[model samples]
Target: MECLLGLLKVKVVRGVNLAICDPLTHSSDPYVVLRLGQQKVKSSIKYHTINPEWNEELTLSITNMMHPVKIELFDHDTFTKDDSMGDAEFCILDFVEIAKRDLSDVPDGTVMKTIHPEKANCFATESHITWKDGKISQDIVLKLRNTETGELVLHLHWVNIPGVAR
Candidate 1:
């Protein structure tokens, strides 16, 4: 099953209105970290700003569609421990569904197709899917929780590999 799927590219576009962990001070240096399975990627630290823009892209060799990608925000510290700002997560099941449907045109096997989310739901507002450059991509905006207020914007591209079983 590991060799059946292709790579998934995740682009961490930017963060908006991140919570300031250090309220006593003026501003906090914010940074983002993304985790998927054992793979981890960190964004550059934006110094003394509430709204940090980290236009970074990370790629992951996806084998399982059930795994959810974790996005964690933190305040960088020089001496002491880093403060945890907030976090958000999103799954790639929708992308996998699209990929399977797009690859169904191949000669040999039949792949399953799924419907896109068009109604108001928990995972509907910030998630969207589209086809571009012979690939299926999704853009997601996740609202950070366990803190005051924060949001993370992400763009994911799923490349389809030929001759792979769905």
Candidate 2:
């Protein structure tokens, strides 16, 4: 059995101006799949839109804090394999670090960390790890790599496991 570490509640809020992978209809049926190690969680497919609001919450188990989370957007096809829209990756180390803090005095909506878009990262714009509603979380707008004209917005919530100290 795997040692209980933590749970990452990933809220896949929406996609912004995604690529039109389908040529005939000029739109794409897109779905998001998030991978952490050997675990994969997928969201429902939203059809015929460049901008789709998923509002999906995918939970991923955390055994290694250093593991990178991978996000991929695919165009769901009925008769063929799903076409890849693009992919991006992120790390939860900073968020996890803040979650391990004693933030009794930290104000709600306080920004703990601000991450900017660099060549080494997938952030489309800036991101903030904030303390909100008595939890550590972050909102990010990731610029998709290997594709033109697409961005993904998501929220990362850190859930601690009881009886296990990390």
Candidate 3:
């Protein structure tokens, strides 16, 4: 299946107004962990801050659209263990319809419709689709479950693999 893999590029832009998980210090050393099946990638830790800007990019070979990508926020700690702040999940199927649209066929400033997850612990309110960098890309803003306090921004690009069916 590796030969049929499509590249999914995910850019974890930044987080805003994240929950302060550390009660003692009233701040959190936040970092993001992205998981797609057995593959996992982590961002650099931002010490003692509720808001962290990690403009990190990760590329994953996706063989199945059924597998949802998990995004979890954690507070890095030196002592015991990392604390779970919040989490969100999104599937590549969410963007399948929009991604199938050819970028060259669409006019500039054309905004594709946003997609929402059917069931998710954390999910983006909306995604803005635009033609950028010679391809179609999306900017997604995800909000934490059970509260409107935490927000995480992500940029995603779908790179088509030759001989793979969309």
Instruction: Name the best candidate (by TM-score).
Output: 2
Q: If ranked by TM-score, best first, what sequence of candidates would result?
A: 2, 3, 1
Model 2, position 68: C-alpha lDDT score? 86
Looking at candidate 2, the ten consecutive residues that score lowest on lDDT are: 1-10
Give the TM-score comparing model 2 with the true structure, all chains together. Answer: 0.95
Off by over 4 Å in 3: 97-103, 116-121, 146-148, 161-166
lDDT of 3 at 83: 82
Give stretches of model 2 more than 4 Å off: none
Q: In candidate 1, what are the lDDT values of residues 3-113, reduced to their tens digit? A: 547778888888778888767776789988888888788888989888777778887877788888787889999999999888877767777766777453544332233
Clashing pairs in 2: none
Each model's C-alpha lDDT? Answer: 0.73, 0.90, 0.77
Q: Candidate 2's C-alpha lDDT?
A: 0.90
Task: Give the TM-scores of the predictions, in the order they appear.
Answer: 0.79, 0.95, 0.82
Task: For candidate 2, write residues 1-166 as lDDT tens digits.
Answer: 7675788899999999999999999999999999988999999999999899989899998887788899999999999999999999998878777888879899889999999989988998899999999888999999998788899999889898887785
List runs of model 1 lying over 4 Å from the truth. Answer: 103-124, 161-166
